[model samples]
Target chain A: QTAATPAPAETWLPTLQVDTPQQGFDLAIVMARRAVKTTQPDVAVLKAQRPHYAGDAARLIDVSGVAAAWFATIAAANGYWRD
Target chain B: QTAATPAPAETWLPTLQVDTPQQGFDLAIVMARRAVKTTQPDVAVLKAQRPHYAGDAARLIDVSGVAAAWFATIAAANGYWRD
Candidate 1:
Protein backbone atom coordinates (compact mmCIF):
# COMPACT_ATOMS: atom_id res chain seq x y z
CA GLN A 1 0.00 0.00 0.00
CA THR A 2 1.12 3.54 -0.68
CA ALA A 3 2.08 5.79 2.23
CA ALA A 4 -0.70 8.06 3.42
CA THR A 5 -0.29 11.78 2.96
CA PRO A 6 0.23 13.85 6.07
CA ALA A 7 -2.60 16.09 7.20
CA PRO A 8 -2.12 19.86 7.00
CA ALA A 9 -1.16 21.60 10.24
CA GLU A 10 -4.33 23.68 10.23
CA THR A 11 -6.43 20.54 10.08
CA TRP A 12 -5.03 19.48 13.44
CA LEU A 13 -6.24 22.64 15.15
CA PRO A 14 -9.49 21.95 17.02
CA THR A 15 -12.60 24.10 16.57
CA LEU A 16 -13.77 25.30 20.01
CA GLN A 17 -17.42 26.23 20.50
CA VAL A 18 -17.98 29.68 21.96
CA ASP A 19 -21.28 31.59 21.91
CA THR A 20 -20.58 35.03 23.41
CA PRO A 21 -18.02 37.77 23.87
CA GLN A 22 -17.84 36.93 27.54
CA GLN A 23 -17.01 33.36 26.66
CA GLY A 24 -14.34 34.61 24.28
CA PHE A 25 -12.78 36.80 26.92
CA ASP A 26 -12.94 33.98 29.43
CA LEU A 27 -11.20 31.62 27.03
CA ALA A 28 -8.58 34.27 26.26
CA ILE A 29 -7.85 34.70 29.95
CA VAL A 30 -7.58 30.94 30.35
CA MET A 31 -5.15 30.73 27.46
CA ALA A 32 -3.09 33.61 28.83
CA ARG A 33 -2.94 31.97 32.25
CA ARG A 34 -2.00 28.62 30.74
CA ALA A 35 0.78 30.26 28.78
CA VAL A 36 2.18 31.82 31.93
CA LYS A 37 1.89 28.55 33.81
CA THR A 38 3.67 26.68 31.07
CA THR A 39 6.45 29.22 30.80
CA GLN A 40 7.16 29.58 34.50
CA PRO A 41 5.80 26.30 35.96
CA ASP A 42 7.28 27.21 39.36
CA VAL A 43 5.37 29.36 41.81
CA ALA A 44 8.50 30.38 43.66
CA VAL A 45 10.03 31.63 40.42
CA LEU A 46 6.86 33.58 39.70
CA LYS A 47 7.02 35.13 43.14
CA ALA A 48 10.61 36.12 42.56
CA GLN A 49 9.65 37.72 39.25
CA ARG A 50 7.03 39.82 41.04
CA PRO A 51 9.64 41.90 42.85
CA HIS A 52 11.20 42.89 39.51
CA TYR A 53 7.77 43.79 38.18
CA ALA A 54 7.03 45.88 41.28
CA GLY A 55 9.82 48.23 40.32
CA ASP A 56 8.79 48.39 36.68
CA ALA A 57 5.80 50.71 36.34
CA ALA A 58 6.34 50.96 32.59
CA ARG A 59 5.94 47.20 32.18
CA LEU A 60 2.78 47.33 34.25
CA ILE A 61 1.43 50.08 32.04
CA ASP A 62 2.35 48.12 28.93
CA VAL A 63 0.48 45.09 30.24
CA SER A 64 -2.56 47.19 31.16
CA GLY A 65 -2.49 48.81 27.73
CA VAL A 66 -2.56 45.39 26.09
CA ALA A 67 -5.40 44.29 28.35
CA ALA A 68 -7.46 47.40 27.58
CA ALA A 69 -6.88 46.97 23.86
CA TRP A 70 -8.04 43.37 24.07
CA PHE A 71 -11.10 44.39 26.08
CA ALA A 72 -12.08 47.16 23.64
CA THR A 73 -11.67 44.82 20.68
CA ILE A 74 -13.81 42.17 22.35
CA ALA A 75 -16.44 44.80 23.15
CA ALA A 76 -16.53 45.96 19.55
CA ALA A 77 -16.90 42.38 18.36
CA ASN A 78 -19.84 41.94 20.72
CA GLY A 79 -21.39 45.13 19.28
CA TYR A 80 -21.84 46.52 22.82
CA TRP A 81 -20.49 46.32 26.34
CA ARG A 82 -21.40 42.89 27.60
CA ASP A 83 -22.01 41.88 31.18
CA GLN B 1 -0.43 71.82 47.95
CA THR B 2 -2.03 68.78 49.59
CA ALA B 3 -0.60 65.32 48.80
CA ALA B 4 -2.28 63.73 45.81
CA THR B 5 -3.99 60.37 46.00
CA PRO B 6 -2.91 57.63 43.64
CA ALA B 7 -5.15 56.96 40.63
CA PRO B 8 -6.64 53.50 40.20
CA ALA B 9 -4.44 51.19 38.14
CA GLU B 10 -7.17 50.55 35.58
CA THR B 11 -7.34 54.25 34.78
CA TRP B 12 -3.92 54.11 33.16
CA LEU B 13 -4.93 51.47 30.63
CA PRO B 14 -5.54 52.89 27.16
CA THR B 15 -8.80 52.07 25.41
CA LEU B 16 -8.10 50.90 21.86
CA GLN B 17 -10.85 51.35 19.27
CA VAL B 18 -11.77 48.23 17.30
CA ASP B 19 -14.92 48.00 15.18
CA THR B 20 -14.92 44.38 14.04
CA PRO B 21 -13.89 40.81 14.90
CA GLN B 22 -11.15 41.09 12.32
CA GLN B 23 -9.83 44.12 14.13
CA GLY B 24 -9.98 42.26 17.41
CA PHE B 25 -8.09 39.28 16.03
CA ASP B 26 -5.55 41.56 14.40
CA LEU B 27 -4.95 43.40 17.62
CA ALA B 28 -4.68 40.13 19.52
CA ILE B 29 -2.01 38.95 17.11
CA VAL B 30 -0.18 42.25 17.49
CA MET B 31 -0.31 41.98 21.26
CA ALA B 32 0.84 38.36 21.18
CA ARG B 33 3.76 39.27 18.93
CA ARG B 34 4.67 42.23 21.05
CA ALA B 35 4.66 40.08 24.18
CA VAL B 36 7.07 37.69 22.53
CA LYS B 37 9.27 40.55 21.34
CA THR B 38 9.36 42.10 24.79
CA THR B 39 10.10 38.84 26.55
CA GLN B 40 12.94 37.74 24.31
CA PRO B 41 14.19 41.07 22.87
CA ASP B 42 17.21 39.30 21.46
CA VAL B 43 16.74 37.62 18.10
CA ALA B 44 19.49 35.09 18.78
CA VAL B 45 17.86 34.00 22.02
CA LEU B 46 14.56 33.56 20.19
CA LYS B 47 16.30 31.44 17.57
CA ALA B 48 17.73 29.26 20.33
CA GLN B 49 14.27 28.77 21.76
CA ARG B 50 13.06 27.52 18.39
CA PRO B 51 15.15 24.32 18.53
CA HIS B 52 13.64 23.39 21.89
CA TYR B 53 10.14 24.06 20.54
CA ALA B 54 10.85 22.02 17.41
CA GLY B 55 11.06 18.85 19.46
CA ASP B 56 7.95 19.67 21.50
CA ALA B 57 4.86 18.62 19.56
CA ALA B 58 2.65 18.85 22.62
CA ARG B 59 3.49 22.50 23.04
CA LEU B 60 2.72 23.11 19.39
CA ILE B 61 -0.62 21.39 19.80
CA ASP B 62 -1.39 23.45 22.87
CA VAL B 63 -0.59 26.65 21.01
CA SER B 64 -2.81 25.66 18.09
CA GLY B 65 -5.64 24.70 20.42
CA VAL B 66 -5.51 28.15 22.00
CA ALA B 67 -5.54 29.78 18.56
CA ALA B 68 -8.54 27.71 17.42
CA ALA B 69 -10.41 28.54 20.62
CA TRP B 70 -9.72 32.23 20.15
CA PHE B 71 -10.84 32.12 16.50
CA ALA B 72 -14.06 30.29 17.29
CA THR B 73 -14.84 32.75 20.06
CA ILE B 74 -14.20 35.68 17.77
CA ALA B 75 -16.44 34.13 15.12
CA ALA B 76 -19.22 33.61 17.62
CA ALA B 77 -18.92 37.16 18.88
CA ASN B 78 -19.17 38.46 15.31
CA GLY B 79 -22.29 36.29 14.87
CA TYR B 80 -20.64 34.40 12.01
CA TRP B 81 -17.35 33.73 10.34
CA ARG B 82 -15.91 37.02 9.16
CA ASP B 83 -13.46 37.80 6.42
Candidate 2:
Protein backbone atom coordinates (compact mmCIF):
# COMPACT_ATOMS: atom_id res chain seq x y z
CA GLN A 1 0.00 0.00 0.00
CA THR A 2 1.28 3.44 -0.92
CA ALA A 3 1.35 6.13 1.74
CA ALA A 4 -0.48 9.28 0.75
CA THR A 5 0.93 12.73 1.30
CA PRO A 6 -0.72 15.11 3.71
CA ALA A 7 -1.66 18.69 2.99
CA PRO A 8 0.48 20.67 5.36
CA ALA A 9 -0.12 24.37 6.01
CA GLU A 10 3.29 25.02 4.49
CA THR A 11 2.14 23.87 1.07
CA TRP A 12 -1.11 25.83 0.83
CA LEU A 13 -0.47 28.97 2.82
CA PRO A 14 -1.78 31.44 0.29
CA THR A 15 -5.37 30.43 1.00
CA LEU A 16 -4.90 28.02 3.90
CA GLN A 17 -5.77 30.51 6.63
CA VAL A 18 -2.39 29.79 8.15
CA ASP A 19 -2.47 33.28 9.59
CA THR A 20 -5.41 35.40 10.72
CA PRO A 21 -6.99 37.89 8.27
CA GLN A 22 -5.06 40.77 9.85
CA GLN A 23 -1.85 38.75 9.92
CA GLY A 24 -2.29 37.63 6.34
CA PHE A 25 -2.88 41.19 5.20
CA ASP A 26 0.23 42.31 7.03
CA LEU A 27 2.29 39.49 5.54
CA ALA A 28 0.95 40.30 2.10
CA ILE A 29 1.99 43.92 2.49
CA VAL A 30 5.46 42.89 3.57
CA MET A 31 5.78 40.49 0.63
CA ALA A 32 4.55 43.17 -1.75
CA ARG A 33 7.29 45.54 -0.64
CA ARG A 34 9.94 42.88 -1.26
CA ALA A 35 8.50 42.11 -4.68
CA VAL A 36 8.67 45.78 -5.61
CA LYS A 37 12.24 45.93 -4.43
CA THR A 38 13.10 42.84 -6.48
CA THR A 39 12.17 44.72 -9.64
CA GLN A 40 14.72 47.44 -8.96
CA PRO A 41 18.20 47.36 -10.54
CA ASP A 42 21.62 47.77 -9.00
CA VAL A 43 23.02 51.23 -9.70
CA ALA A 44 26.66 50.30 -9.23
CA VAL A 45 26.51 47.34 -11.60
CA LEU A 46 24.85 49.45 -14.26
CA LYS A 47 26.94 52.54 -13.50
CA ALA A 48 28.11 53.04 -17.07
CA GLN A 49 24.86 54.74 -18.00
CA ARG A 50 23.95 58.37 -17.40
CA PRO A 51 23.54 58.08 -13.65
CA HIS A 52 20.05 59.43 -13.04
CA TYR A 53 20.41 59.33 -9.26
CA ALA A 54 24.19 59.21 -9.23
CA GLY A 55 24.77 60.30 -5.65
CA ASP A 56 21.77 58.38 -4.22
CA ALA A 57 23.09 55.00 -3.13
CA ALA A 58 19.84 54.22 -1.37
CA ARG A 59 17.87 53.68 -4.57
CA LEU A 60 19.76 50.64 -5.88
CA ILE A 61 19.07 46.91 -5.44
CA ASP A 62 21.54 44.15 -6.25
CA VAL A 63 19.92 41.70 -8.65
CA SER A 64 21.74 38.65 -7.30
CA GLY A 65 20.55 39.35 -3.79
CA VAL A 66 16.85 39.25 -4.69
CA ALA A 67 16.21 35.50 -5.10
CA ALA A 68 17.84 34.77 -1.75
CA ALA A 69 15.82 37.48 -0.06
CA TRP A 70 12.61 36.48 -1.79
CA PHE A 71 12.73 32.83 -0.73
CA ALA A 72 14.02 33.75 2.73
CA THR A 73 11.07 36.05 3.38
CA ILE A 74 8.58 33.51 2.11
CA ALA A 75 10.02 30.68 4.13
CA ALA A 76 10.50 32.79 7.25
CA ALA A 77 7.01 34.29 7.15
CA ASN A 78 5.49 30.84 6.75
CA GLY A 79 7.61 29.30 9.51
CA TYR A 80 9.15 26.89 7.01
CA TRP A 81 12.72 27.90 7.76
CA ARG A 82 15.10 26.07 10.10
CA ASP A 83 17.72 27.79 12.24
CA GLN B 1 38.06 50.90 -25.86
CA THR B 2 35.31 49.02 -23.98
CA ALA B 3 31.78 50.10 -24.87
CA ALA B 4 29.92 51.25 -21.79
CA THR B 5 26.41 49.91 -21.12
CA PRO B 6 23.50 52.27 -20.70
CA ALA B 7 20.75 51.89 -18.10
CA PRO B 8 17.54 51.60 -20.08
CA ALA B 9 14.23 52.30 -18.42
CA GLU B 10 13.71 48.54 -18.40
CA THR B 11 16.70 47.95 -16.12
CA TRP B 12 15.71 50.49 -13.47
CA LEU B 13 11.93 50.35 -13.66
CA PRO B 14 11.38 49.44 -10.02
CA THR B 15 12.55 52.80 -8.65
CA LEU B 16 12.61 54.61 -11.96
CA GLN B 17 9.42 56.22 -13.29
CA VAL B 18 8.67 53.60 -15.93
CA ASP B 19 5.02 54.10 -15.21
CA THR B 20 3.21 57.11 -13.74
CA PRO B 21 2.12 57.19 -10.12
CA GLN B 22 -1.39 56.01 -10.99
CA GLN B 23 -0.07 53.53 -13.51
CA GLY B 24 2.59 52.23 -11.15
CA PHE B 25 0.05 51.92 -8.34
CA ASP B 26 -2.23 49.97 -10.62
CA LEU B 27 0.61 47.76 -11.81
CA ALA B 28 1.74 47.18 -8.26
CA ILE B 29 -1.79 46.14 -7.28
CA VAL B 30 -1.90 43.80 -10.23
CA MET B 31 1.55 42.43 -9.45
CA ALA B 32 0.65 42.03 -5.78
CA ARG B 33 -2.40 40.00 -6.72
CA ARG B 34 -0.24 37.77 -8.91
CA ALA B 35 2.41 37.32 -6.23
CA VAL B 36 -0.26 36.22 -3.79
CA LYS B 37 -1.63 33.83 -6.35
CA THR B 38 1.86 32.38 -6.85
CA THR B 39 1.93 31.36 -3.21
CA GLN B 40 -1.27 29.31 -3.64
CA PRO B 41 -1.09 25.60 -4.45
CA ASP B 42 -3.05 23.90 -7.22
CA VAL B 43 -6.04 22.02 -5.90
CA ALA B 44 -5.99 19.28 -8.51
CA VAL B 45 -2.40 18.35 -7.79
CA LEU B 46 -2.86 18.34 -4.07
CA LYS B 47 -6.34 16.80 -4.15
CA ALA B 48 -5.41 13.61 -2.30
CA GLN B 49 -5.45 15.50 1.01
CA ARG B 50 -8.52 16.59 3.00
CA PRO B 51 -9.24 19.02 0.19
CA HIS B 52 -10.23 22.02 2.27
CA TYR B 53 -11.63 23.48 -0.91
CA ALA B 54 -12.85 20.34 -2.61
CA GLY B 55 -15.85 21.72 -4.42
CA ASP B 56 -14.41 25.06 -5.35
CA ALA B 57 -12.19 25.18 -8.46
CA ALA B 58 -11.90 28.97 -8.58
CA ARG B 59 -9.70 29.12 -5.51
CA LEU B 60 -6.82 27.25 -7.15
CA ILE B 61 -3.90 28.43 -9.23
CA ASP B 62 -1.71 26.18 -11.38
CA VAL B 63 1.92 26.49 -10.35
CA SER B 64 3.34 25.93 -13.81
CA GLY B 65 1.20 28.65 -15.34
CA VAL B 66 2.50 31.17 -12.84
CA ALA B 67 6.01 31.73 -14.21
CA ALA B 68 4.76 32.31 -17.75
CA ALA B 69 2.05 34.62 -16.48
CA TRP B 70 4.48 36.42 -14.19
CA PHE B 71 7.11 37.11 -16.84
CA ALA B 72 4.47 38.00 -19.41
CA THR B 73 2.92 40.57 -17.10
CA ILE B 74 6.25 42.12 -16.16
CA ALA B 75 7.41 42.24 -19.74
CA ALA B 76 4.10 43.55 -21.02
CA ALA B 77 3.73 46.19 -18.34
CA ASN B 78 7.28 47.39 -18.96
CA GLY B 79 6.93 47.32 -22.77
CA TYR B 80 9.78 44.82 -23.02
CA TRP B 81 7.99 42.55 -25.46
CA ARG B 82 8.57 43.00 -29.17
CA ASP B 83 5.34 41.46 -30.47
Instruction: Let me know the TM-score candidate 2 reaches against the reference structure.
Output: 0.19
lDDT of 2 by residue, A1-83 (tens): 23576554343234423333234334544554445545755645445542422221211112112222343343345443111
Q: Which pairs of residues collide in model 1?
A: none
Listed models, DockQ each: 0.04, 0.02
What TM-score would chain A of each candidate receive against the reference chain A?
0.45, 0.28
Deviation of model 2 at B60, angstroms: 20
Angstrom error of the Cα, residue B53, model 2: value is: 16
Regions more than 4 Å wrong, model 1? A1-34, B1-83
* Minimal lDDT window, size 10, model 2 chain A: A55-64
What tens digits encode model 2's per-residue C-alpha lDDT throughout B1-83?
A: 23576553232122212344445445434443333333323433333332432243432333223333433333444444333
TM-score of chain A of 2: 0.28
TM-score of candidate 1 restricted to chain B? 0.44
Q: How badly does each model clash, as a count of residue pairs?
A: 0, 0
RMSD of each: 15.7, 21.7
